[model samples]
Target: MSKNNKISALSEKDGVNKPEILSSQVAKHIQAFRKKEILATELIEKIIAGDKVALSRAITLIESTNNNHLEKANAVINGCLPFANKSVRIGITGVPGVGKSTFIEAFGKHLTGLGKKVAVLAIDPSSTLSHGSILGDKTRMEELVKDENAFIRPSASGESLGGVARKTREAIILCEACGFDTIIIETVGVGQSETAVHSMVDFFLLLKIAGAGDELQGIKRGIMEMADAVVINKADGDNIQKAKMAKVEFNRALHFFPPKSSGWQPKVTTCSAVTTDGIAAVYDLILEYISHTTTSGYFDAKREEQNQYWMLETINEQLKNSFYNHPEIIKQLELVKQQVLNHEISPFSGAQLLLEAFKKKT
Candidate 1:
C-alpha cells in the first residue's frame, strides 16, 4: 500500500460526538454537591426535603461498616424516625428468572404515575466465593430510575442471610422519611431472606412464573404462608392461559392455609411485566389490604411488634459483631476452628470456649 494513498485502517480519526450519559449541568451539580461534606443534620434536612442525592448518601452511611460512620448514621436515622412509618412497605420475592426486576419496574412506574413517590430497595445476592454482587437492578429498571418521583437503590446481600441487606430496615426508615410513600423491598428471591423481609414490610408479595410446578410444591409452605399476595408474573401472550391455571391453583392453595392475623385474606393474581397487564390491580389489592388492616388497627399494632422484634434483633446482631471483633476472639477463632476441624475438640465445645473467651474479653 502506498503510504499516502492507502488509508490506514488502524489510524484514529475524530469520531462523531458521543452523547454524554450525564449532561454537563448534572456533572457540575454533582461536582458542587460532592465538594462539601454534608453534616448529619444537613443530610437529614435534605432527605426530608426529598433530595435523592442526600437520601442516597444517608443510605450509604447506614450501610457503611466503618465505626466512624456509625454515630452519624445513627444520628441521621434518629432524626428521620419521626418522619418515618408514613409509607407502605412492600416485600417482593420470587425465584430467579421470575421477572422480578421487570415486575418491580412496571409496578413502580404505575405507582409513580399515580403521583406516589416510590423507592425500591433491591437486594442483589453476593457470590459465595468472592462476596461480590452485580447490583444491576438499577440498570434493569431504566424508566423507573429516570423518574423524578422514584428512587431505586441496589444493594449487595453480603454475609446477611435472607437475601436482604443488613441495613434494609434502616434504609426503609430513611426512604419513608425522604418522602417516598411507597417502599418496595425486593428480596434475593425465595429463601430465608423472605422471613426477614416479611417482618419488615407491611405487605408481602410472592412473584411466580406459570407452570413452574409451584402449584403442587409444598416445599414453599413457609413462604406461601408469609405471602399476602401470590402474583403469577409473565402472564402475557402464550403464558396467559397457564397463568390463569396457576392463579386458580394458587387460590386453592391459599385456602389450605389459615387466615392471616391482619384479618385480610391472601390474594392470587396474574400479571405480565412486559405488557404491564394487571399491575394496577396489584396496587389496588395492596391498598385494600392496607385499608382493611388500618381500619382494624392491626397496621399500627403489627408495626409495634416489628419494632420490638428488630430491637432485639439489633441487640443480637451487635453482640455477635462485638464478639467476633473482639481482639481475643479474633486471635483465637481460627485456632479454635482448626481444632474443631481436626477433631481435637467438639464443635459445641469450641463454640463454648470461644464464648468464654469473648466473655473475658468483654
Candidate 2:
C-alpha cells in the first residue's frame, strides 16, 4: 500500500498507537496563520484600509478562545478603536415569524442603493444539546449576504448574557474602521436577549406584525418599552389595513410610557418588504433620529454611556472569571456546594467561604 498506510499497518502489528497526522488541507490553513508571521498590527492596518479578508481574519481572532489569538484580537481592537464609533448602530428585534430577515434584506438593499456601506452582525441562538449555532436566519437575507458593500456575520449567543452581542458591538467598530457607515445588530428575538441588544445599539427598532390578536401578540410590553421605534412588517395587500391600524395602536400605546432619555418620540410605521414600499420612510426616519439626537448632543452622550456600561461589564466578567477559575476556588467549589446542599453550612456562609478561598489567589 501507500507509505503512510504501510507504516500504520506496521504500527498496529507492533501494538503501537500511531501518532495523529495533520491533514494536508488543514496544514495549508495552519501554515497560512503561522505565529508572528502576520502581525496583528499589520492586520489592523489592512482592516482600517478596508481589506475585507483582513477584517474577517481580525474578527476570527476576536472570536477565538486561544490565549495567543485573544491577545492579538485585543491588540487589533485597540488599534481600531480610534477609528470606531463613526457609524450609526441600529438594533433590530422581532418575533420569529415577523419577517426580520426579509425586512433586513430589503432594507439593506435600499441603503446600498443610496450608496451607503452596511454591515449586519446577527446573533444566532445556540443549540443547547450540541452547543452549536443554528445559523439558518442569516441565510434568509440572501441579497444582503451577496452585496459587495455589505458584510454579514452570524455569531452564536454562547458567551455571557449579551456577551456575544458585546463582541458584536466590537465588530461594529471594526466595520466602521473599514468605512462601513451603517451597522445593524440583529438579535435572535426569541428570548430575554433583546435587553442585551437594546443596551448597545444607538437606535433600537422593534419589528412587529399585524393580525396576531390582542393579549396574544407574542411580543412583551417591556420589549416595546425598550424600543426607540416600532415598525410593522409585511404591510402588503390584505394586511395593509391591519398594519395601519396596528401602527395607530402602537403609537397610542407608546404615549403612555415615560419620556425617552433622548427627548425624541418613538415612532410607529408600516412597511412592505415584498413591494419595497415605506422602506425609504423607515430610512428617512433613521436619518431624522440621528440628526435630532446629534443636534441635542444625545447621540454622543449615549455612546459614551454605552462605553461606561461596557467598562463595568468587562470588569464584572473578568472578576467572575478570576474568582471562579482560581485554583483554590475550583478545588473548593464542589465542597462548598455539598455543604450548602446538605445543610452543613448556610448558603451565604458557603459563598463567603468560597470568596475567601478565591481571595487567597490574589
Candidate 3:
C-alpha cells in the first residue's frame, strides 16, 4: 500500500480519520499553547519561571513519539529559549546505591535554596529494557521536586547506551530555554560508556563510594579521564576518612593525565550527598571550572563543537530512519540479513545492494 493508504488504513482501524484528526490535534495543542490556557511555553516557562509542573510536562512532550506533537513542541522550545538562562550543565554518574538520587535531592535543594533554579533530568536505563520507568529519582527527590524553583524529570533510556536517553540533548535545550540556571543530567552508572553524557554536558562528574579500595577498577580509564571532577560520596561517619583517602588517590591519578579541555584541571573532591555536606563545595568547583574555561574562551568553543556533534547525530538518525522506512528497503532487509548471516556475500556488498535498491525506489 502507498504511504497515504497505509496511514488512512491505520487511522480507520483506530476508528478515526487520519489526516483530519492529526491536523486537529496539532491545531488544538498550538492553540492551547498560545491561549495561555495550556501554556505550552509555560510548561517550560514555569520551569524557568521556577514552576515544577511546566518542567515535567515539557520533558514529557519532548520524549513523546507522537509525530503530531513534535512541531509545536519545537515551537514552544524556540519561544522559551530567550527567557532561559545559560545555566551550568552538569552530568552526574555513579554506581547503583551510591546514593545518586539522594545526592541530587540534597544537592538540588542546596542550589535552589541559594536562589538558583535547578532542573534535574534523570536517565533511567532500566526503563528502556522493561518499557516502564519507576521515575525513582523524582520520588527520591521528594523535597526538591516539591520546590517551586526546582524541576525534576525522569526519562527512560529508550535503547540508548550508558543510560543516556535519545531525546536528552533536546531536553537540555528545553530546560535551558525554560530559564533553568542549573541543569543536572543523572545517568545510570553501570558501564564505562558514560562518555555519551560527557559529550553534551559542560561538566562531567563521576561519583564513587568511599573505601572502594580498587577505585581505579571501579571506574574505567576512559570515563575517569573524561571527568571534570571526581567526587567521593558517603563521606559521613566512618566513611569520612576513606572518602578523604579516595580523594587523595584520585587527585594523584589525575596528575598523570593531561587536562581534558585546555586550561582546566579536573579536580577530585569528597561529599556526603545524604548529609548535604560538601555538596556546596562540589557546586563551587563546577563554577570555578566554568569561570576559568569561559575566561580562556574554551567554554564558547566547546559549545560550538557540541553543536557540530549534534548536527551530525541528527543527520545520522534521519538517514537511518528514512532508509529503513522506505518500502523497497524494508522488503529487502530480511533477504540482506539472511545473506549476510549465511555468509553468502560480504556485509559491505549487502549494504551496497540495499543502497542501490533504495536509490531505485526514489
Candidate 4:
C-alpha cells in the first residue's frame, strides 16, 4: 500500500478508538489530591516522618503569598522547629558558566554514596523585567534528581535575593525536619544572593572555573572573603595546569584577608565534574572544616548568630509586606509616586507619607 493509504487505515471510521492513556480512577485520584487540604499539624507529622511529598507541600505553603498560606506556613515552621537545625547546611555559589549544577550533582551523588541524605535548594535566577525563571535544576542535576537519597528543589530567585533567602531558610528547616542530614543551598553566583546565602549556611563554598579570568577580579569582591572553601571546577583536559595555578593564586589572595572568626582557614582546590576528579577531596575538606568548627564551638555559635539574623530579617520582611499590602498605603502609593515623579514632593517625603499612611492603617 502507498504511504497515504497506510496512514488512512488508522483513522478510518471503523477503526478502533484510541485507548485512554489516563485511567479514570487515576484521574479522579489526582483531582482529589489537588483539592485535598492538609492541616499544618498533619504536614508537620508527615515531614518529621521523612515524607518527601509532604515536605515539598510544606515548602510550597511557605513560598505562597496568600495570607492564609502565610499563617499556615508559619504554623508548620514553628511546629517543625523542634526537629530542625539538625542538619549540615551548606551554601554553594559561583559565577555563571562555572558548572555549579554539574559539580553539585557529582558532589550530591558522592554524599549519597556515603549514606547521607541530601536536600538541595537550587535557586534559579529570575528575569528582572518578566520575573520568570528557567527552573532547570532537575534537568541539570539529572542524576542527583533521580537518586532516592537526594532531594532537589528549584526555587525562583524573584526580584531580590532577600525574599528568596527567607523562603530558602524556612525550606532548610523543613528539609531538616524531613530527616535530610545535609542541606545544600545553591544560589546564583552573582549579586547579593551570595551574602544572603552566606548568612544562612553552616559552610559557604565558592565554585570557580580555571582560566575564566575572574580569579583576581573575584578576589576584589567580598565573596572570596565569605568563602569557606573555593573549588575550581572543570579541571580535566589540558586545563588542569591552569586550575592548579588558579588555586595557588586564590590561596595567596586568601592569606591577605583577616583571619576568619571561626579560626578555620579557607582552602582552594580544583575538581572536574565530568570525570569526578577531586570530588571526594572536596567533601573531605568540608568534613574537616565542620569538625574543626564544631570542636572549636564556632559551629553552634554561628548557628545561634544566624538564628538572630533570621529573626530580624523576618521582622523586616513582615513590615515591608504589611506596608505594601496595606489598603491605605496601596491606594495612596500611586498618587504619592506620581507626585514624586512630577517633582511635587521629594522622594524621601513621598516615602514618609506612605509610611505615615501605613502606620495609621495599622
What would the per-residue lDDT of candidate 2 be over residues 103-132, giving only the tens digit for each residue? 888999999999999988888877666868
How many clashes show up per model? Answer: 1, 0, 4, 0
lDDT of 2 at 82: 94
Q: Rank the candidates by TM-score, best first.
A: 4, 1, 2, 3
For model 3, where is the 10-residue window of minimal lDDT? 8-17
Output the number of the lDDT-best candidate.
1
All candidates: CA RMSD in angstroms?
Answer: 4.8, 6.3, 10.6, 4.5
Over all chains combined, what TM-score does candidate 3 have? Answer: 0.82
- Higher-scoring candidate on TM-score, 3 or 4: 4
On residues 1-362, what C-alpha lDDT tens digit does candidate 1 reach at each position?
67778877898989999788999999999999777678999999999999999999999999998767888999999999999999999999999999999999999999999999999999999998998899999899999999999999999999998668999999999999999999999999857899999999999999999988868773357999998999999999988999999898888888888788888899899998999999999999999999999999999999999999999999998888788778999899999999999999999999999999888777
Q: How do all models score by TM-score?
A: 0.89, 0.87, 0.82, 0.92
Off by over 4 Å in 1: 1-37, 218-220
Which number leads on TM-score? 4
Candidate 2: the clashing residue pairs are none
* lDDT winner between candidates 2 and 4: 4
Candidates' C-alpha lDDT: 0.92, 0.83, 0.80, 0.90
- The parts of candidate 2 lying over 4 Å away from their true place are 1-37, 162-166, 214-221
299: Cα error in model 1, Å: 0.9
